[model samples]
Target chain A: MKTKNMISIWFFVGCLLALYGALILAAGLQTYSNRRSANIAMQNLHLQGWWGTGLLVIGLFYVIRFRPRRLR
Target chain B: MTSIFSAMLARTWAPTSLIAAASRVMSLGGIDLTIITLYFFLVLGLGLYLKKFTSTGEDFFMAGREMTAWIAGLSFISANLGSLEMMGYAAATYQYGILVGHAYWIGAIPAILFLALVMLPFYYICQTHSVPGYLQLRYGEATRSLSAISFAIMTILMSGINMYAMAVIMKVILGWNIHFSIWVSSLTVAFYVMAGGLLSAIFNEVLQFMLIWLGALVIPVAGLIETGGWAGMVRRISENFPGQDFTHMWRTLGSFTGNPMGVHWTGIVFGWGLAISFGYWTTDFLVVQRVMAAKDLRSAEMGTIIGGLFKMLVPLIVILPGLLALAVLPFKLVPETMANVPGVHTYNEALPLMLARYCGPGLLGLGVTALIAGFMSGMAGNVSAFATVWTYDIYKPLIRKQASDQHYLSMGRWCSLLGVVVSIGTAYLVMNFSSIIVYAQVVFVFFIVPMFGTVVLGMMWKRTTPAAGFWGLLAGILASFVLWLCVKLDPSALRLVAFSSHAKDMAENVYRAWWSLLANVVVTIVVTLFTKPKPEEELKGLVYGLTTLPSLGQLPIFKRPIFWAGAVAIAFVLLNVLFW
Candidate 1:
């Protein structure tokens, strides 16, 4: 059961990573076609800023909500 | 004329040189004037006030270990952020790309999360005053002794690197000589750290944190705006690099071969975040002091996590500016040419220099003030940690047994004074030796790796014997030294260079430092597994019990999504890593 749980978790993570990678690959291609510089990529990242903040807030909530049963 | 010449000669040898140089430098308009004035008085005031706090060893040394998580978290950030992060990351980012973000993705997030989740619980359970004390509990007195000595030496070397780095920045930015800059910075930092201990250190960091943000963040924001907003920056970046892979975080400009001396992604992620972070979060007195001082275990744990979250935004401030600088300024005639231009020597000075020249006065002054503030924050943290190590780790156990709290606190104050003097002396050595960032890395690789091995394994495995602990630690140190020798003599390692003409010489030294950490970890694990396990009595409170978990203690459950969130975060980071 534990092995199954662990494997499922890994699978879910693998898929998410694959998705993120795909998006970046697409972005990279677009950047290349458009002849983007490193700063442009960073600026684009800034322009699309709140993604990380949302992820973080979600992550924080998840960690807090699922805290260990015996915790003070 | 003859009499006037004699008088001038006498004045040259007089102590007034520092005062004269300091005042003349302070006379500069806008940014510099603000820095000099703020630096001069703030540091002096901190030192005098510390006189009151210095009455006992406990008070002087640990601030009686009564600090909050926020203070501890801030000081930890300040200590690590230093000029290196300010200057080095910015320069690196300017030259490289979002690839530098790999540092956050691979090293920082996981490492800090692991520190909080995996290690902190055990420290609270062990309930020791310091990492060394925890060592004594898990490994025995001999391992504790060895661990303490190594930690102290590393801290001194690190303080030296930090002090020198800040001095260099001040000199370059303000057009002061290295010698004059060193004394001015060292004296002021020493004063408040001597007076306040952790209290002053923490207080200064809250202020310093703001400065670091300004110097690092404000520059990038303004640079982006000046260059024509976010879209304009993107437009500019695409225009220059031409058909480049900018979106992927790991694969960016100049990252692939820029650091041929071997600080690649593996090193930054695994070596820096995993190996180095474990040692720092678990063992380093700077962070541990805060955890020990926390109002409760949960608060301590939460504060560290808060700090980690704050660290997530750091690269945005520090590294991005560096990348921006590289784009904004044309590829110069080497680092020295850029450095000699009064704004570009070290990573810390890069942003301020850019802002001063490019941005208007008010903004430039604010940026310069941030750098000074960052320097002061770093210095304050170093002094506080030195005082703690001296008082708790060294003085109380070795020097006196029946000393009063007041007496111990007083001893702590005196210790802070001595710490400042020693640190200043050490900083002078760093000034003559290497850049602060490189020096800090060398110290990290050689000194920290072995300590990490003992502390991590000792906490996890109940069967880890003191005999194993001592031998593992000894072997790790010996192994790293031997590794250092191999890298030092290697021909390929000798081929690299830094910004100086003496780059080849310094590169060889750094290569030795880098490779040694890999050797230390390998030898430590091998020695540990082969040796005997710790006795049950020694292991009792040290390792986690199957039953008594800190997070699970008496808390009612919400339909907690935290578990699912943790799972998702893992997914997100992996996706970022694999895809980007």
Candidate 2:
């Protein structure tokens, strides 16, 4: 009998990071539009948007690459 | 109540205070809470999904020995990378300057390499389910029982301490209810571990490792940017504290009074670099079990080498942030005792303080989730290890010798639940009587050194008798306890153990471990000479001279364990010299 492959841990990690990235990116866009100053240092760099985009890209790559496939 | 528990933890670990800053508590925003909630859902989902694969006893206890090198390697380090170590070492860096980096480098790397290149083959060949199982094979049931019982008690108590510490941190940092944090986290861990066992634990540990890096990485990056770079940070620290060598790792080690930690170079080398480091990395089943789950002998060795590499980088997230806090944070951090005053922060608050300084809403949530992941993963590691040892070493052998594989699997699940419950009980016990934490530390110190001595002797020397292993371990424990009591009764007597009047509690610990290990080795040698040795035939496959080590000649140098270990060693030396 052919054994089924278990879901990769990276898939879960990817999904979580992707979801978090999108949420953070939306929040960042809202903050940017409102032109409100956050209490954190280096806020003007728009780190939220940058970091969120980075996470989204990496997360999406991991999700796609490690996604479970049926064994033949 | 939270402050009291924090104070107790501060006292137990010493110098690295866990007290909250006197400033207002930080609360999570909606986005942040959502990220944290999603983590809970994901872990539970993973556990439920993995249940079908965990039907057999081997699957439940060992992940069916099917884990790849990467999975096993990441989980191995993650199991040790708990919130306590992260927070404590960061705080240590803040207090003692860069000298604390020695713990991550010299204190860990060589021993980890030893485990990968030398010790792991024996464990892999033996097919032992746990460290105690290996002991039973090398010695006898008596030795196994002693090690397993002590380990079980220690693990559960440690899990409880981790639980309580996390709850207190949550209460102090986020103003959450302590009971709510404890119960929610404990029940979640227990449920998932019961469902999927070691596989579930390993999966979550790998995820936690990633979360920890991403969440905590922001602080060091932002700090470096703000303070220029490594050179600028060093200059700032020197300017802040005049006439002090806080940036150099080895320059201040010539004399005990030369460094903030009051430890000499000898203590760092023989005591920590040899005894304590070898004791933990080689023998601790919690981390070793992860490697034991690897798919092959090469996978196990490669996994350990992988762990050693990541361990070398952990200083970036943990130690560098503490250094950054000293150079960049606007407010000065006092000791835990002085943290009660307004605007005063404890050294332990370095990590969280850096988090608040650099992280805004969504990022703040991610950082907090990373800490929570660390705490839960630590608790899960302890509970899972405890369950396995209890079922295999204690229940199966001592209580019921004859049982079906399904029966043992059922017992393993029940023990996992029971371990969590006991850990919760230990948490409350600590809440009432905080001194138990200090006692637990002393007891742990007693075990590790002696156990390492016994195991190493048993494996390398075929003439070692079972009686020698048992008695030698007992002698080491008693000798360590006596030394501790002497220091307790007469503080000046610490010189006997640590070799100097200026040596602090940390130095005393390492020296004490070295002495205990020496006592164990000497007594084992003496006892072996008097007692009848195990027959050479019986020692086959277990003893070094009698066993045939596998040939690695066919594998390429890049794939060999020795080659990677050499790479790790070179990196280790470069790091030491660069910091020196």
The C-alpha interface RMSD of every prediction is: 17.9, 2.4
User: How far does residue B349 in candidate 2 sit from its true spot (Å)?
Assistant: 0.7
Q: Score the docking of each candidate (DockQ).
A: 0.02, 0.57
Residue B462, candidate 2: how far off, in angstroms?
A: 1.0
How far out, in Å, is residue B227 in model 2? 0.5
Model 2: per-residue lDDT, tens digit, B1-580? 1111111134425321344444544778898898899989998898898888899989999999998899999999888888877887787788888877877789889989999988888998889999899999999999999999998998888788778877877777787878899999999999889999999999999999989998999888888988899999999998888888888888899998999878898888887788878878888888899999999989999999999999999999999999998898877777776756776777777888889888888888889988988888888888889889999999999999999999999999999999999999988988777677777767765677688889999999999999999999888888888898899899999877888888766778778878988999999999999999988888887889899987766887898888999999999999999999
True contacts kept of each: 0.00, 0.51
Those runs of model 1 whose alpha carbons end farther than 4 Å from true positions after fitting are: A1-72, B1-32, B39-58, B228-231, B241-247, B252-269, B330-333, B336-349, B399-402, B431-441, B493-532, B551-579
**lDDT tens string, model 1, B385-416?**
76666666666677776777777677767776
Model 1, span A1-72: residue lDDT tens: 011111111122223223322333344444446665433223444321232233234434544553334424
User: Candidate 1 DockQ category?
Assistant: incorrect
- Among residues 3 or more apart in sequence or in different chains, the pairs in candidate 2 whose N, CA or C atoms overlap within 3 Å are none
